[model samples]
Target: MSKQGHKTRANLPAGGFLAIGRDVTSTSDTSRSKPQVHKRELPQLSSGVLKKPRLDFSGKIPSSTPSTSSVKRAEVDDSRWRSFCAEIQIEPKQLLASLESAKEKQKPQKAARLICAAVREIIDHRKEIGSWVEEPIMCSALMLFVKMNTSFLLPHEELIEVLCSLLSTNFPTSSPGSAMAPLLLYKLLMRATDWNWRLVESFIDDSLHERQWTDRPSVDGLIVNIITAFGTRIPHESMYTACDLTYPERYRTVAEINRFTKVTDKEQKIDAFVMQMRDICERKGESAPRNLLRTMCTCAGNGNVRLLAARKMDSWLLNGKLQRYAMELLLWIASNIGQGELTEEDSETLSSLLKLRALKSKQINILFNIALKEILNNDKGMISAVAKLLLSNEFSANRFPYNMTMIHSLFSFDNRSASKVIAREIAQMLAAKEEYLRISRTFFREFVRSLLRMDFDFALFTSHLFNAATEDFSVLTIPTFFFKSLIDFCVMLPFLAITPTIREASQQRRSANGNLTQTHIDALQKFYADLRNFFEICTCFFRKHCELCTDNRLFVYSYYRVLYLAPAEYYTGIDQWPVETDVMQYMRVISDVPISEQLLCTVLEAGSDASVPIDAADTVDVIENLTKRASLSSTLTGSSMVPISTSTVLETIFRITEYKPPPTFNVQDENLPPLAVKTLYWKAWLISLIWTSLNTDTLVKEVYYNYPNLKLIMQIVLTW
Candidate 1:
């Protein structure tokens, strides 16, 4: 090294740098004196240095070392090797030998490259491998290649192609294997790219073929993942908005619909319909059921398909001329199959189908109406067949009638009066049948309420229903159904005033999204009309039954206790308040009856009996109990009438006759016939009524003398 080079390199270390043919400074204490250069040659470093090269857009990593025969470990953890070795879950050598033998048996590939080429060919061709089906084989192959070569970045085009293939035309995303396919590909895409979600949005549209994104779960899920890949806790509303933004054309406004009417007037032959049914059986998917329903309905009026029951079968099938072809097909099937044709298994299947549709449907479907008609017509021992096909084990007869209140949507159709008539007739039949009555008592009140909603000709139809409803209340030994039947008549009276509340509820559901079609609006209005009329008829039936109060004290007490309540805890808003116009009918009947001496004695006995004293009325408790019952009623019938205040009965009686109530009774009494207190109240209540009716402020005492009384008086006088 030269002196100048030495000076430049001298600062590299405290010891002076060595120059060629120059003296070097001693490294240790030998340099204690002023350091003098020692003669030395320049030393070379052991490790070689090279400059790094710049990377281009190709993004390929440069090789670090020269190629060798020995296998080299790449930038991966020990677990990856463990994973690759444990793929067969066996010793590495054994797995290799097994794979080698399998490979030889399948194809005599000379090298691993040939097998790789064959796999590439399969991916390109989209063929199913020997035992592995198309989905599993392709999905696994892609997963294996990416997982093993974790650093390898796949081309965006190939990734898009793979994603697109899994979601080809008519593929069912909800099916087990199919739903998982896109998820797997999505995972692969995640591993394979640093691509933006925007890229996926652009490519997914290009990739999707036949089905719209909203139509299938897989597509929707895939699209959601694309939009929210890097996001967390996205709301459902935002997801919907994302869908609307991503695919504007598919989710057009209802006003943009070009069709004048929604009805699809397709005509298919019977053979075509059968073939469609066969396809439904062979294929696997959610779409299959919907498609099967549509195809069958499309074949309506084909050979052997007749509309025997509802004359406007076409209109019902068309269902507001669109959007309900499925229901019509189910009805058509039941009607066409007739009695004795369905096997036990077939019956079970049909019943299950009806149940599934019923659970999913919001309105009364055609299947229900058809089943009801089968029950009504009772042709060819069809009741048994209809029973087997339409009724599920989940519900006894009572629940069916309970469900029918809203399902009476068929009331909006042309057969409206007949449908109501059929329902009343069904209830009568069920009531008559011991088996049905025992099991179906749950629905006793519901059937009565539904019957009351009709365009009733009381003399012709309702008279019989009311007779059945009020049947033999004289007998304390009656089924629970009959008991509920009486309660239904009383409670339903309040509903006559609350039609506007129901109308508001119907309107909220109708116009919630501002998507109400004219057809839907009309149907809803008609349905609301049917319900309004249904509850109003209770006024007439109740007025007819006013005689019961005078005849049966037990019923009279139950009626007054259930029907009236305190004003403070009244449950309804003004809209919910039923009109009190018909109140005078039942109220006046309850208002002014004379108190008999015999009744007063009964009241004194009821009050004096320590073990049977009635509970004092608590407004809070009364309102709470009424609220619970009202909630239960709403749950059962989909709508509930506002409950009357419990205090009303006492208040009305007090205002009428200025009668004071008896002292508060014991609270813990649990005596039999549970109406002990109400009975006492009724005894006093009727006195108020009588006082009002007589228009008298007071009653004078009276005594009658008989011969026995005179003789007893003379004997007492003689003794004195």
Candidate 2:
């Protein structure tokens, strides 16, 4: 027969097995001495019968030493190899028969050679064969064969060149075949722990730059693919210390990645990387691991892949253009760090990042407004998510940098309409369920601070809100520190003392009676006016919450703590409290709640011995240790439902009215503020004012009998 005709006949599909050209020159490094690969001539198919390769456990692989691509006899699994060949469409039984026949002849290398030829054939003709090469079966076959019989692997250097060549030279980068061809090579090389990975080292060393792969992107992606694939099989991939893989060295890249990464406009590169990540997240689900975020933070520990974008956030001029990109990137990363639900630690990291980059007050407002808008514009699901994040403990407290500025942003935004909604929603949310208070405590306290900063009109609005209350607002849910902070800001210290900025602004007119401009006086008057309704609303809320003692003991304890917050006091011309009776009525209502070491101290320390309310009554000798603890941390167990009745308060009040302190000033003896003394001073000033106002219908003059004997001390100790 003619040569071409013979080749055509030889190419025909076999009945059971198609005879293939076989070549094997260098299987192991020792075999490299005779490195020439000579192809065997093919004639026709044979219906070869089945037989298994002999097991050889004597050539056992040391578990301590990871195996190289150069396979050992004992590493060979006879059944797995057969299964692998079958997956690659080799007809396992026939391939086994051929292998067994070769072994009989002491030439098992021939079957290895045939399998390699078949793999190469599929790879080379992947396009002509369509998606067949993309099949999972094909991938599994290639991985299994290379992993099980690595001793039969194509020469390491040659295989690297061949795989790159097939993808870049023979196929288009966009082709599925081009993308997936390296998967098998990647498996083989990665499994071969002894491999020097000269291809990778050469790229990093730039040895291949002179003849660099033209379809550079394809090669770059394949390299990244290889690196990630290696991650999958690692024992503890997230912990590099546990694995031997040198990630940085492995990640060292050539043309495509380095090309774009080397671009001059660092912003452009960062934007590109971020957009790429965004696309990835959109393709995958939101909850998928944020690889890019991990990469930016973790990999950048060594400063990789345009990591300077985050570090240089402050240097970028907000020329209005570049900041948007950086902002978008930051927001994207923040949102995805935990799929629109960052954990506490992630929230802290984000807070630090923003704080570090927040160069100006305006920038804080901008982000604050954005966070607020997310809550305002989106559905409840998004609101809850954004609320959790934007109001995370890191950003909601007095300590966070720019937290006041954040509040100010809301104060000044779109006439503070959004801020109003936020405050109302928070109040209603907390009041409706006790759990909301625990989770959203800092936010509520900060919102209350912001409310204190608002004008008289806003305070009146909030006051009316509680008066016509509809929800289940519980003061017991309010954290003890929260109420204690309120006392410090409103009663013990000037309201402006809470924030440094406001304090500094008020330095010139620190006191209400100080020499001041009309504007300053007007501002002070408005602030104080805001306070009347503010404290009154707080009083009303506490009074109502006091009623909740029937609800629980925590409510019971928290109510009395709220009463002695700054000690009982009367007001003179403040609109809310006019007469001593009104003051007394307020006290009676709060004390009248049906519900401690803590109880005796407050009653004695706060009630007057012999004075009544006056413009400026003699300052009472201050009571000591009647100070409420920093928080109801230990004492207020809230373990029962019975309220502390008005009778208990009345008994304690009469008993302590006669008590006296050592008549010496050891005032400098303690470093902590004299909160109890100051509280008594204010109480004395208000006690005479606590007489029955006789105006209300529900409260009768007879309630005065609740503590008539206590008014004797009310005559002497008026609150300043």
Candidate 3:
């Protein structure tokens, strides 16, 4: 038969198998010197058909310790030889099969051969292929073909061009063949772990310019298989290739992912993959066990692909990319979603990543925000996650950072109860664990120091929102340090306090107060309620122990004295004694009440005592300091003001009322202002005025009458 005729006849339809040609001379020499490969050990595929060759690696090994190395090398060489032989046979059989297959299944020979040649060239020179500068379209097309073959017969690096080419192609839904081509292309691209990541990026860029996937058939099975193979192999496929295969946005990259289906269902697929990877990754460390998962995660992030791509996040976490990539993905994705929808799998994965000793404080903070957001959003499964993280030996509350937006979202978002619950959890944690409290106290102190300078705009601030005359203090309010924080926050907003009171003044002053919205009233009420709840908690605790501590009369007296200065309501059912006073007297009689322990000792030690005294002069000094440090303009009439105390007196009063520790005189600092020191001394001067005003007016009325009840509180503490 003519060569041409034979070639044509060979191109028939039977799914022909190929057998490679071995160079007889090289094979004989190598066979004698090298060890043998046991082909029978390989796993069988589809119908017990062994598509592989009996690579002969058992010939010999020069007695250099006949170690596994020699055996491995021999085996590798033999396998290559066998693969080459298989390719040779297939050259004839594959062509014939392609030509004769049902015409519907047949693709053009030129296209197929071009792709095949490209893959062969890559397999032959993987190292050289990485350096190839010429962008070959044929080679690119081959990448699309070889990406999913699972045989590992081709070099992954050369598939870059293929990915780039495919990415550039417009959506081809015109024919079934064309549609199937992309799916096949994605499968192949998924395998090119060694390809240049930049090439994958180029594909994303090009995909941005092209059309989107619409009614696109999901190659879910193909993706599943690829993930399965790589889960075990952890192949070094390009991240962009993984992203393109998983998330194809028809428009601008990552942001366009929203056009795809809701990401909720993808959790199941990711969870399964993660479980598989966990099982496999723990088994044996391979050459590049983490490479496949890391690359895939990176691709998802870069491509702006959401959902399925996000499912691989655990893979990144397990791979120890928590610091570099995993944390960022976790935070960004949580923010994008409402945070309430995070899957348990995601929480597990994140928790595992954080447990790694390699993670840094900054990384922890990022994770904290994610967890905090999840809690804020009321993710059902996240409570346990937060608890676990908080208890971790690596937990550092101080490391967590918060932005205004995050704070706003925390208060404004739907899961208000969840926020309160988390806050309580944190409080319980602090109370139970000394080490945790010490660390957390430092963190909260720093937070307080930083907060005075922050902007909590009432207009946009979530704290301004209310439900049935109540503010959403669940996020804004808490029982421990957070309660103090909320008070401080409200105190910083002098106008919120001043405006309501001013409006209640005579008509002249009332006219000056702008029309206060119901939001403002609700905010004030919420703020008060939050404080009231905090006081109740303190009272409740004291009531439980006061009976035991009464023998220590000083302790009870000191505790009552501090309480008297705090803004408390007189219980209508009882004598006009303050709740603080009432509780103190009851605890004063308890015989077991550690009488040796004085209230002064407790107050000094508590450091967290909210009733620390401050005076007018001290307040002014702080105002001056705040003026110097405040980033926002001092103007109160417009949008620039960031609610800080008005004058030194108001500042001291606010500090006293809001639980801020009174600034003490630095006797040694000669440079310190005399007036500031004098203010601390005069803390008691306004007490009488404050005490007298309380009986006749409500909190709203006392401040409304411009009686300077706030000023009285600060002045009295200084004088006392």
Candidate 4:
């Protein structure tokens, strides 16, 4: 044999001399140090032909002569494999055979470790054989394992760790089977015994904070699926567990989660779960968990979910538990959802929220602002519904302050629609005079003030009021102050040009030609119609309760102010010339008092020039005429009327009064009629009669009791 061949032969195993496929040649000693041989290559025959080596049936084959199959078997028993089997206390082949068998029969206890091992292996080799997770065998085996070992798996934190790792690592790509990891996890959780929510929560926390699953939608979908699967199985005792499990502290709110991923359906399920828990709590007479309430609040962005959540919250609010949370959820729905989509239940929920007087002012403001926007933008009956609620008897005095602001905001958002609905409700309330009187005074004032703020067609409202009062005279029996508020609202309409402000704005809008435009003519014509309707309403009211018109000095003053301040153009070309004269005639007819010409002259003179000092004899004559008309005295004797100056008469009359003459009713405004001056002085004369005839204590009591009316009158005067 050649020296190189000898050296190769010398290096061969003791059991056999291996053959080389390549030629052996003389080479450097360093290159011949180790012989490189392909494991599969067999020793050659003596004729130098290749053939498989015969197995040695003799004592035992040399360990160094192990076949390629044995070497591969050794590689299978690597450190990872040994550790996996050791941890489960199962042999490698036994675990595999058990898993294979478990796929069919699902033997209890025997295959639990096998199933876990299979999953661990699948995850360990995720990058290479991730597709294996999608196989039917693997999926079936996993489901069976969970079914058979539910008790064991429930507390098995190690298995949970492995599954969560799989979820975190198996981020789905465009690859065909990349999503199977989450699917398998979902199926496992769904079929498993009730999960240890603590473990589940930890998983979610890790997935969100550590894995940043929210950064990847597919991964987020995986987490959402897992949560949905486990969330439904949450025990009622731990119902709030789903909240933290589904939406961890890292993702605080569903809204914040939405910023990163879309788990809308999952959030809906969580809401339903929490709501079910709330119902359970209610039945047991236990307070609902506030964490669950907070969970529902965070998830209120979903429409259907929010509706249900709103109702749940409303119940809590009514029961006076977690009212803050209930209010929060309701306001969220109101602001986020359109008013049109708001169900009647939602409206009631918001109404109930407003009814919660214990809520902070800021929360009330938020609730009302949302409701106002909803009423305006929503074509649903929310406008009418909320309007009725605001005007309802249940909206008590404690809530009145908030209700008033919300009512005004409603009108501000949509003047036309809001006012129409509100007016209709007010009219209906008027029909039930007793019930209407029961309404909050603040609400009634706000109703009137709201009407005045918007471009409401007062003609319609006044006509309704007139018809209602005519049908039932008791409808006109509201407080004199409220009646005045109504009158002030109707009489001060923008198109009527009755209030000083409207007349001033109208005068400023007149053309250079000093002629009204066609638009102005139409408005003026409509104003005449509305003014007539309003006068009809006033006539109906005064006819039934003429005492209210005559006895209430403030009422009488505003009534005469509205009647006399009416633009002259409306009553022009008619024989019943000044409407104030006609109103005075009606008053005299109703009360059997004679109309005094001296009083009319005094008003006309005051209207002609308010700055001019009245002659004392004229004032004394006016006072004597008023006193005789009032029947306080048939005539003022000279001794009784001795030395009474104009200042004394004026001070006695105007001292208790604080009303300012309207700026627009001055000589500068062309719209004011020559007889319009009677509004201030006639008001003064009638006020003096009512004041002098009535007890001073009574007058003082009326003035003091109706301070709100005084404030309202001041607002009107300033606005004018």
Candidate 5:
């Protein structure tokens, strides 16, 4: 054997070779080393030589020999070789200068030629790969390549090919045995400036096409990891920007989008990857939710992917996937955590999605219905989730009213579509089932409470009320009842009502047109006017009784008992209009002299009977627990209303006043009552003479003649 072979054998210690006694080789045979040379000292190569050394063991390495691989290993381990790799660096400017110079000479392809030459040289050096693996050179090279030209560095045609070859499975490792090449590649991809997205898109496209990259057992998961790393370095706003950049125009073809999403297969791997991401997102911790959500929102702009993400979010909510933690995470994301600036598209898409829906409408609406159906069909835990999300402070108040309106429309439409028998059966079932109404009532009450807390300008609330009030009265009985109760509570509850900041809320609301079209307003006004006349007649009945009564306090107490109780009962018994009037009249006669006289002769004559009047002074005095009841005239003027007094007697009196009086009163009184019977009779006379002297109709007509438009404006403002 040649002496060069002996030296090669000496280097193969790990391969269990002995280098004892080999034949001499001629110096003229360049591939064979001389025996004399082998006898001399074998010193390690210096750093400079190791950096770009030429291997002398080519021919000495035998073909078909098991020992050939050992020679390559020895060269890699040389310390000087390792240092050369660590210190290897490229000056980007020089490389660019070289490419530009070549291109300037009229060789248009020269720039790529130079780049290709450089790549080939590095690959051929033999020592460069070893240096790259054993030292820190790889990270620096990757960073430089990415940081320099970014996406511009790669040719559009060659981008995918280059990335796949360069990013093969057998990546280099650090001293710690951690494969860092993949990580370095990932870091570079993430740090990719705007210029690099095209390259990324191309690379992703190629990866999805490759069977090894997609069809493997863990490939989908691996792809997810790649995406995660890629996502971490991208600015949140970039997603929206990218979306804007890609939408409706630039990538005007399906192929272009397919390249972006890397959708390899319609089923199996692709679907599994999408599904896996959705599941992970649903299960993620709070720390990960926003990041993952933003990532998904960005990457999942493709319609199918977006649908998937929406499904996952819905599933997380409905399946109690993460329980309360999921809700909290969703809230945080919905509330825009960590997002510095909101893009219009992001705001629109996200806000529109958070709205609750009971049935499908559009594509997005389908998502809402699916989620609701899943939740309703699956588990009771979902009930809590639904309530929390709908009632949560994070969601918008406008959503519930709109959604509930949609739901009611759906239910009514469905009911109408059913056969008469089915509809009747359903009504029977609903009537029979107490729990349904109870649940529905709770749901609606909470919803109405949300609406009440909304920052309503008078114009908005009136519009809302007017629109609601005009709906088919039969269909909307529940909502109208809710509206009435809500309004009453808003007026009656101490904290809820008495909005000092909006002193003109009532006036402003009355002035606003809202959903009440002119026809509706006119009808409401006429109806209320008739109601006023009826109440006035009842008031007259009470005044006559007050004149006959001897105990003034009892009469006053009984008057309040009737007054407080009448309206609610009458308002509720809307089906029986005149019968309500008769009952109201019977109770009216019990009022104390002054209150009875004021109600019959003065206040009811004004518009006080049309709308319920709350006296501010009465409320304040009541809250203070004073026994003083303002004169009925003062209440008519809305004096000093604060809150209803909690006084035991007053509260009791008010409670009793809310009750309907028992029947058996004489209703046929005509010419029997006369003046001067009591103070009530005298007060009634004083009120009658005051009105008779002014002649209300004549005064109103004269005012209208003087100011023609004033009556119209007053009608618009006061009709409510």
Candidate 6:
């Protein structure tokens, strides 16, 4: 047989496999006829045994049955051919015709050598085929093929090079193939066992410089995909390096970058990378790069990431923009993380960061609340740190309310050690300078009120305050309202032991004989001691700063009320009535100070009315009688006792007689000024004092009864 004929016969379909090659010498009609015959015979051959061929004159019919090895080889080649045809979107006959045309174009020996060399080259460099493909379809097809061939993996270095080249090309403008480059490269890199991060980073740097890749909407997404793939493979340190190199410096803020990139979730890897860089920087005792911090700001919504970023806030405190961002980041973390998760170091760091004067009041509030939570958890170090922060210069007048509120919260805790620490800091704040008084009077008053409401050890706070007040009387000159609040707190101290809650607790510890336990006795004695010391300090304060008393009569009245309500046992055991002497000295200094005519009329009016309405009082008769009495006294004594006007007396009567329940006497009066409240308190105590004195036949009543003039004076004073 001729060589061409043998080749043609060998190329015919074997078993049921499709014929991959055709005879080049055959005409189109003959080729078409031969394929039809094979197609008809293939199904029958596959389903059952081949029928015996009829005896022919042309020797025995050539055996059409294929050997086992030939059948297996044919099947494998047929599958590969079908897949290639499917991938290229061509029919088998069309592929065969094209192959024959290509064969006709080149000599057989040369074509064979070329085919062998190409096969060898593909086998040797199969891993690099992804980079060599320039067409988008071919690149995607090659990557898909590589994915199916599990044993083959492209080198990441070549993948990165291809990705960079694709990124540099303007896709949908220059070469549409670049559009699939990111996805193709992603698949290739995923299959790689190891990556060249430096090469990846270099590619990223180069790609970032090309505005087409980063600015164009269609291309930027592809670029981000490439970055995301790189992120998945790159180590954190290398990722950080890549971020530093690729992040655009022109975009100063996270918001700006987010707006420009429009790739929100894709930047999570960048966020993580920057946070790691910051942690590393902090571990090395260095400040995080400012850009790294700015990157962190973008991911502040991530609680864990924000918390990690908050640790480096100290370095950013000096930067105006970063400082604000850092503070906001901290606020977010504090709000999201568990309260118990805050560590002492975290609290201390927040406290230190709080020193920035640029912090907003709202930001300060959040930071303080975080510290406050730690304090309530009984973290002593946090307590101390927070206390210092409260007193720091950062807590300006704008933040004073929040500062005092924080202190109040700390004192509210049942933890004694925390209270003591907070108390010390509060004392320092109160006495550190006189300025806090004028600036934060209302806050301080509420703070003191809150502290008194809790079961706090009043002595510790009062003692510290008293010691500082003694060294500097100005300390006692905190706003009159705050000072009065302190006095009210002191007055309540002695009665704390007898409160129902205290009494019940003490009763539980009572001895078998029904006597108070030594613990209860010691507590009572401490209360008295603290109360005595407080009153003594007040006396000294009034003596030196008598002008303060004159300016604030409510404060003076509060002091006198505290003195009058204290049990006599407190003074009897003390030496020479030092507190009492100081009080008398203060009174003597103010003796020459003229009483306001209104005060005189209020006194007479209150004395004259027996059935005074608790809510309102009629002062008309009282004022007329006071005017007439002043005139009568002036005539009788022939002295220049000026007759006060009815309006002045009426004004004084209204001021003094405006009745409201007093807080000082276990009454819940919210509207009354502190002085009026104290006056009502003193009036109730005075009535009790008079009743007790009369019942006991005290010396003052005996004197009143013994002298006729004194009898008349007492009679007038007692009559309503």
What is candidate 6's lDDT per residue for 422-519, written digit by digit as tens?
Answer: 44555455544555433333343345555454354555555555554344445345554445434444443333323333343244433355555566
Superior by TM-score: candidate 4 or candidate 6: 4
Off by over 4 Å in 5: 1-101, 120-156, 159-198, 201-297, 300-441, 444-465, 468-720
Candidate 5: clashing residue pairs, number: 12
- Could you list the CA RMSD of all candidates, in the order they appear? 26.0, 22.9, 22.1, 23.7, 20.7, 25.9
After superposition, which runs of candidate 1 have C-alpha atoms over 4 Å from their true positions?
1-406, 414-465, 469-477, 497-552, 556-720
Ranking by lDDT: 4, 6, 2, 1, 3, 5
Q: lDDT tens string, model 4, 570-670?
A: 33322232365544433332122222323333333442333433332333334444444344321111112111212234344443232334666564435
Q: Which numbered prediction scores highest in TM-score against the true structure?
A: 4
Flag regions of model 4 displaced more than 4 Å.
1-294, 298-332, 335-348, 356-368, 375-379, 393-399, 434-456, 463-500, 503-720
lDDT of 5 by residue, 609-661 (tens): 21223222222222122112222212212322112211222222222222122
lDDT of 2 by residue, 220-274 (tens): 4445433221111111122222222233333345211221222244444334444
Lowest lDDT block of 10, candidate 3: 588-597
TM-scores of the models, in the given order? Answer: 0.25, 0.31, 0.31, 0.35, 0.33, 0.29
lDDT of 1 by residue, 1-720 (tens): 367676656643324443433376555676433233332222212111112221121111232212111211111122322222232232222333433554556522221222233233333333233122344443444444444432333333334443343333223333333344454455545443343332333322222212223344434434434432211112122222322323222123211111112223223222433343344334422223333343333233232222211222323334443325434444444433433344444344344433442433334443455444533342434444433333333254423332453334323332444433443543444444445533333332344355544332223223444555566343443443443334433343333322333344444443446454555445444443433333233333443454433334343344233334323122232223233543333232212111222222232233233333222332223323333333322211232223222323334322222223444744443432334344435444443232222222222111012223334444554588
Better of 4 and 5 by TM-score: 4
- Residue 241 alpha-carbon offset, candidate 1, angstroms: 35
Question: What is the C-alpha lDDT profile of model 3 across 49-162, one tens digit per residue?
Answer: 422211122211112111221111100112322233234322322433332342235433333333444434433333243323223333333333445333433433323344
Query: Taking the candidates one at a time, how many backbone clashes does each contain?
Result: 25, 37, 48, 1, 12, 1
Which window of ten consecutive residues has the lowest lDDT sum in model 6? 67-76
